[model samples]
Target chain A: MGKIALKRTSLYASGASPVNLLQARFYNEDCLVYDLEDSVPVQEKDAARLLVYNLVKYQRPVGKYVIIRVNGIYSEYIDEDLEAAVRACPDAIRIPKVEHAYEVQKIAKRISEIEKAAGIEEGSIELWCNIESYLGVLNAREIAESDPRVVALALGAEDFTASMKAARTKASLEIFYARNAILMACRAAGVEAIDAVFSDINDVEGLKEDVKLTRNLGFDGKTVVHPRQVDVVNAAFTPSKKEINYALRVLAAVEEGKRQHKGAVTLGGDMIDKPMELRAQTTLAQARAAGINV
Target chain B: MALNIKQTAVAGTMESSDVMVTVKPAEGQGLVIHLQSNVLTTFGDQIRATVQEVFSDFGIRDAEVFLVDKGAIDCVIRARVQAAICRASGEGFNWKGEDK
Candidate 1:
């Protein structure tokens, strides 16, 4: 298949725990990310890597997007991590701490070598670059446009906030600029952008509010850590009932305008042109993909 | 290849339903197992049997396995032991999640 569909909920589970792995695979998260970065302890990295490799190679996560979060590009474990990652044939490889375009290029090179050696197709595995550092946020556009294998850009809010020496608040005003910049870069590159995880998992209301912010920010999806958070994510990514109705009306108006041989149309006293029609079409498509009854 | 312990290696954690398996070279003629588990009273023999089964599968004849179990299941115990033995045998790229 082409690059895996952008899932609304990307769940990050600990690679060291098989129970967590099973949960993530069976859960509602459309994307399952086996995290070998921060979740695994230093000494347990090998164990986690082995388990993740086995899960990717031996077992099939049917109806799920399987991704691996390897160590940071500059970390010591990336080489070994990618060795298993490429051979395992996961849908994607998520690289953390991506500050420059060269990082993605280097990973793409390594993946190319592994694909040849493993007899897998080159560029089969997609790359998701996580922007966490100040430089990463600054060079988000370059990183997004770095390589074709780099299909998605992730906002690593905790690390970004720490790097900026800014505090996270209920409103999250500190990292607003970074989020907007990353999303803008992804838009320019024609790639998907994922929102960061809501660390306060118990606060369902907070998660709902956070997801609304992400949706308004034009994020393709949200990254969640807990299984319970998937529902909120899926709901947030879906176009609401009101949006679907408006989109349908807009499309009908566009169709009428087309039949009348008129390029310009009006809907609800507002000018409806090609751009608005395209936006409406996209909204309806998203709602359909989300299984909404629109 | 026969499984031979080259160094001391440990795998697993102290979390609930987890096990920490440590392996070292055995000076004796065969494998020796020391297990600590919450269900030891009823399942001690079964757990030891499972460890021995894994050892036999790997063709390990001389090694000391120290199993610290926190109610881990059979598959997890097997994986932990497999990881520990792989590390102990100085297996390259195995611990890094590579095939062979």
Candidate 2:
């Protein structure tokens, strides 16, 4: 309530297929989403669920966002997915390829009811919408603003590429429109826009560029696929020291303005009012969330 | 045998024959850890590795550690492990600065 930090966004990372060994590694990532959806295969679903559940149960990391992306809506095991996720009570459940507001409403409603029945804290498990298809891209705004519990939006690159009949390249040039669309939708709806994962694990430089693009485009965070990707993603998403120094100056000016009974102030000769104050506060929030002291 | 992780409050007593020290958090912004030691020295790198490995799963950054031996059984190990977690979690805030 002190200050709202919009930059404190959550990220989801996709684990490799063979989960057990690497899962612990991926779950340890700095991103908020430890995606279980695309990473876990149909066969290892149960084991993955158990592993996630145990980890969450015994050790709840303080202030870290850890949501599980359950299997897709069409997966035969959505019910099981819900059961496992509901039992675990992660910060949220990410639904892939959400085509309409109704999809979000339905999942939100179901999770709400389950939380009621299970006696899990109401609103403990929120919803995350993934815009993966043409329909989903069209409905992105509605999906982002649909449910109060739906706090984040994600781009599903592979499915979206296939749906658009675009080339799947290392640079991800084809999905530019969709990416911007999703980001706009998220910003409009007052939620976080998460960039899609870089599927090609070998393209570290390409991944870095993609991360930069998304960050520049106002993405809150990007989903990662490998442990190697985690460090870079974490680094890129974090507020730079220069930004933090600016934020500190902004906060200082705001404080001084408050003492002087002025509604606004200036920092480094730049106006520091509501919007600027909000942005600086958000920057600080993000830095703090990422363990950056500034 | 079920692996055991245990610790005593800074004010409490811990006498270890086997001790494993796991700093779940290394420096800044510390966090939770599960430490186990048998005959203290026996814990060696494996105990250190296990604790480090477990801490990674939780993404813990900064933490402190200590272990004691009484030639504990597996169950004792589990109890001590819980205690270690509790202490690290700041449950023993009152015992901060007391001798082990």
Candidate 3:
């Protein structure tokens, strides 16, 4: 058995009306994320911030993680959003539309300043970057690897498609390279890679397809706009029984081979080498974190 | 009757069955509500939680509430509770109230 850290899959739901409070309650039970940028209109942004700050004062749910998705680093609202995040002390701050590692450093520096000003410990906050543009995709690896505070990198499909002037069709071939690149970067950096939201709330089948593709691409999880999408994303990201069984088998075989003085072993008629063993270990760890028995 | 519809005060929409209200305190009085609905089990708690959130401006104890609902979204719950409170308190409500 290996130690695993499970980052809760939170639905970034933010709109006026105790959206922050609703998120607070939900996150108390499950992972819930609040977005103060795109989800809120300009006029309501400050109000949203205020509500979020106030809500964070209350006791949060046990084992539920809270993340505030702030505006883009380049946006004028980023400063205010940062101030709010510092005041609220959410588990993580998601900086949307990040293009470069410098942006992460910039936000981290600002967070440090705020922590200093607020008498909070420096580097206590975590950062999550949203790779929503061509430049962001190109720099995804560097960005994820730049700051230790970067817990994950998210791929924003809608914004990415818009930025690339490409259509989001059933196949989504246009964004294939970007998705793979982000996943690779996350893996290289040993952080989570989150997939973008499915825009068509009504198109359940389409959303399912997208989830399947991204999960197959090694995305840790998907961001969901609607509550109905949560169950599907969770199911897609969770390891199947077959995978869990294989992981269990692999571990058992490795243990046995080690006992027999064999350097390698075979499972499912394939040789289980060091890489396969490492993968099996990781799979088992992930399954356990997701509450699936291997 | 299985349910009762009481209008504390009306501002935006009351013509159709979709009632709307904004709960506010009057100069010398407060809002009280007594509602019973066949909406569903524990609907009272849901409505009460929402009313408290939407009208946090008013004193919770000073406000008395009663609601009969036929399954409503959070929006409708807030609207109806506010309308009832406004009607009971005799205070004018701004239909475009700030979101919770």
Candidate 4:
């Protein structure tokens, strides 16, 4: 299958929790992250790995992109996590606390080895690096372009704020630079950029505002901790009806101009240039991904 | 394929669509299973068959398996059983050999 272009929301389900893992696929999010990192306690790591492996292999969720968030690269459990996760054949393996390009390369190399040993196609599994520290933000560009398997870079705001010794707020002013830095890196590398999770699950209004900011800042998606946040983020990322209509009209105008052999395509008395055409195409693509007819 | 059951271990929970499985070294008991499920009367034979299949796949001849089911399906039952057996055996799973 082809890659998913519009991943509006990636929902995190604790790997150790059977109920959550079973129900994760039914949610409206574009991606499902079976997390074995911070969400699983140290004692349950082994059990969680086994559970996630079975769930991914036998009862693999359909219609949604599945990713397994392994432990940190330097941790003792990383090798085992990769061994199980790679064999499980999730769409991607999320590496936490990535600060350099070499880390991604090394992990990708190990993933290749596992794939070969398991008889799975090499490079079939992808990677998602989590940038949670100041150094990670600084080296974001190199990390995003580090390896071909690296498909996305996600900002880990809770840890990033802690690393900077700054407080996390609803306004998210503290990690503004990190967010933009990751976004810029992803854009430059032609990969997707996923925003951090909105920690406060109860504040629906706050989550809506945060999602709006996430979309306005040009993020491809957001990581949601709670199931309730999925629809809000998905809705915010999906193209609105009015925007879809304008994109359709812009494409039609371009086609008409091509048929007439005109120098420039004008939509509603305004010239539609390259950037506008590209934006219109992207809007329609996103609409299509969200299941809109147009 | 030989796993030594060194300790008693438990996996899973009593939540809806989940089953809590506990495995213990039964020495000479030869694969005994005590199961309690809300849907026991409806799915009793199928659940037992699933548990027996997991133990047979693991090459276990003797063990005490206790399961509390809350309407878990076949896959969930298999996962929880494997988790409990692995934990009790104090060994990492051989994914290639046992996962099929």
Q: Pick the candidate with the highest TM-score.
A: 4
> On residues A244-283, what C-alpha lDDT tens digit does candidate 3 reach at each position?
7888899899999999999868987989988778877777
lDDT of each: 0.85, 0.64, 0.69, 0.91
TM-score of chain B of each: 0.87, 0.39, 0.51, 0.94
Whichever of 1 and 2 has more TM-score, that candidate is 1
TM-score of each: 0.87, 0.63, 0.72, 0.93
lDDT of 4 at B64: 94
lDDT per residue for candidate 2 within A1-294, as digits (tens), equals 021233233444442121232243334454355556876666545444544544454444554566778887767867766766777677678898899998888888878777776777787776778889988998899999998998888888999999988888877789888999998999899988888888777888988898888887878877765666777777787889999988888888889889999976877777877877888887788888777766
Provide DockQ values for all models, in the order shown.
0.25, 0.02, 0.05, 0.51
Give the per-residue lDDT digits (tens) of candidate 3, residues B1-100: 0112233343323222232334333333344545445654666667666766755654434444445454444554554454455455544343112322
RMSD of every candidate to native, in Å, equals 3.4, 14.1, 8.6, 2.0
Give the candidate order by descending TM-score. Answer: 4, 1, 3, 2
**Model 1, residue A248: C-alpha shift (Å):** 1.1
Clashes of 2: 21
Residue A198's C-alpha lDDT in candidate 1?
Answer: 88
Residue A271 lDDT in candidate 1: 95
- Better-scoring candidate (lDDT), 3 or 4: 4
For candidate 2, the docking band is incorrect
Q: Chain A TM-score for each candidate, in the given order?
A: 0.96, 0.80, 0.91, 0.95
How many clashing pairs per prediction, in order? Answer: 0, 21, 17, 0
On DockQ, the candidate that comes out on top is: 4
